[model samples]
Target: METDENIRLRQALEHAAAELPPLPDLAPLAVREGRRRRARARFAVATTAFGAVTAGALGIALLPGSDPAPATPAAVPSSPAPSASPGASYPPVVVEATPGVTPPDNPDGLSPAERERRAAHQQRVAALLDELLPEKVTGIRPVKDEVAVYRITAGGASFRMAVSVRPTDEPLAPCPDLPEERGVCETVAFDGDREAQLMAMPVNGPDTTGSYLRFSYGKSRVLLSVDPEAVSAPVTPRELLDVAADPRFLDLVEDTDARPVETKEPRPVAGG
Candidate 1:
């Protein structure tokens, strides 16, 4: 029941299929797979680079000494200005003002009896500085406010030694809160939990400078400062520290509370 045209069509299709040479072995699929692998490697490298940059930025943000960000400013309202001189024009002038440097305010607060007691304590400290220094100290004493001034000859040069006292809970504060005094401070532990902060610096003077030592004894804090002058050699900071740590010097605080005078609280120093 088949026609000659149907038989011819079937025979033609079989011949075409046989001549196609086995479909050329699937067109080499590994090329597409290799391209995919390379893309993944590039993406991983880029991700690692981005992560490193982010970590570096975070580290900078967390650094201890980094400057704080500037504060945002609010919008300002505009106002009409007066006219300038008819024929004169002036350039913009910028002025930078330096903040004032001042010592800590009276810690005892403002009171008559408290002021008298503080004055008495200061007088005693000044007397002690005069009496207790090493035997080599001698000269016509000069007058200075809040400090004991003495002229001394040492190491072939004559210079003035200024001894001052600063009572505080801690030796120094952090960053801006610390005193503006020029010196390097070091803390050394002593008996009975007492600590002595020793500092030394050569300020603006002729090859002469001072050393400062602050310590806590009993309920009060004290500072003993000494300035020595010499062209080639100056007193070592250790000797000054030893003098400050001496038992005789520490005994000065014994009469603070025992005396009938009311005591003043020490100014607090910022601590880290």
Candidate 2:
């Protein structure tokens, strides 16, 4: 009894239903997907926070006026300064000693006390000579077994020097008068009537050059002589006279005059 169009419509509906696929539950799949999405989002947030912290630390380190962390310093040892040697200013004093040499005659036959006194005085005179003489004179030493005599070393040569004090009453020996014996002589006048005679003469004949000087003190006659046989340039008469005129030298003469060093009888010149 149904119409033809209605029957055809029912058949089409049955065919469509038969062709459709069966549906499954979607709850587990949706839960798994949501957990995966949340995990990915947490990882992205952690990465962003780590990057920000790294950049901030770098910026602080690179800042222009910021002080860097201090490092430990290494240890180092210190050294001491150099010190000066002894007797650096003045040249050394040398004493000469020879074995088995016949000691020169001690004509004065000075007693132990007298010899001691003379030795002390001679040392003082040697010190003064070292100060007053030219720098070329390297050293002055007393002659062995001799009084008032010194050996001067200068310009790589040895010379003889004598300083003595005697009674003023004893006349100063005149410079040689004979042509064969005479030398150049001159009288130097000092303050007041004080005068000194300076001479350049021969030592062992006319061929050698020597110097002699004499001056009168209060009551004493001080004599100084030099024999520059080997010296390149001998001490000049003017130099010798200047030393004689020094007040310090006069003081030494005064001491000797107060206490006589020579006997009334004349003795051979010292260091002759």
Candidate 3:
């Protein structure tokens, strides 16, 4: 019952979403760094998340670190605007009205909510990054609001893992929400259940009162939580450490950061 004009409008919108630029090459780091990260005790976790977890190895370019072109530095800096898609990675529940990345929303693969959930989950993933990493990192940069991109190497996998601090607004368009002070901090922590490494602490000054850790290795780095009043917003580092320390994060972390990895190759999602 849709008008001919409506059909054209929808097709146009779909094409817009599909225009996303290709991901910047994320090649792995050198071999020495990879080995150091694997030995890190942080690799010991429970693996409760299963399918949701990401396990990978390094082969070529960069992980999450390499400095993005100024235009798109953090979070795939310089990435061409996404080509509007008729369908996101997954289909929406209401197929009749599913408009990929368009407004109104769709439940498909990378729905706004799904993207937010995946983004938030990075908190846990970042924690594992800190825990399992033993070598140096490089290319730590800010992406859209509340998010950052790190380039690290471990477990024979060279790649970048985008990390975040506090929960950000759900809208996918805006990101790299830099705090008012606009500073960096580094913190490190490790408990029996978790381990974390932080760098580029998002703060203006050094902090000690609250447990915030920030540090960098090459380009891959971490962001930790800093008492807003104490200095700046650093929920990134704190969350990552906490996630890494979790007993369930061991296997995932090990597989993610271990070098000369035996197994742990990530199977692409069904259609991904």
- Candidate maximizing TM-score: 2
lDDT of 1 by residue, 1-272 (tens): 78999999999999999998775554467775565455334434433343233222211111123221112112110210112112111111111122232223333354644444434343344334333444333211222122233333342243445443433345443222224544566777765676677777665564556766666555455555555533422445566666566564455455542442333445655692
lDDT of 3 by residue, 68-153 (tens): 22321122212121321211111001111122322222223354543444333333344444443333321121222223443333
Candidate closer to the true structure by TM-score (higher is better), 2 or 3: 2
Instruction: Please provide, for model 2 over 142-211, each residue's C-alpha lDDT reduced to its tens digit, 9 standing for 90 to 100.
Output: 5534555666655545566888786756566664463666677888787567888888876675667888
**TM-score, every prediction:** 0.38, 0.56, 0.22
Give lDDT: candidate 1, residue 208.
Answer: 52
lDDT of model 2 at position 225: 84
Better of 1 and 2 by TM-score: 2
- For model 2, where is the 10-residue window of minimal lDDT? 72-81
Clashing pairs in 2: none
Please identify model 1 stretches exceeding 4 Å from their true place. Answer: 1-132, 140-184, 205-207, 228-234, 257-272
Residue 238, candidate 1: how far off, in angstroms? 2.0
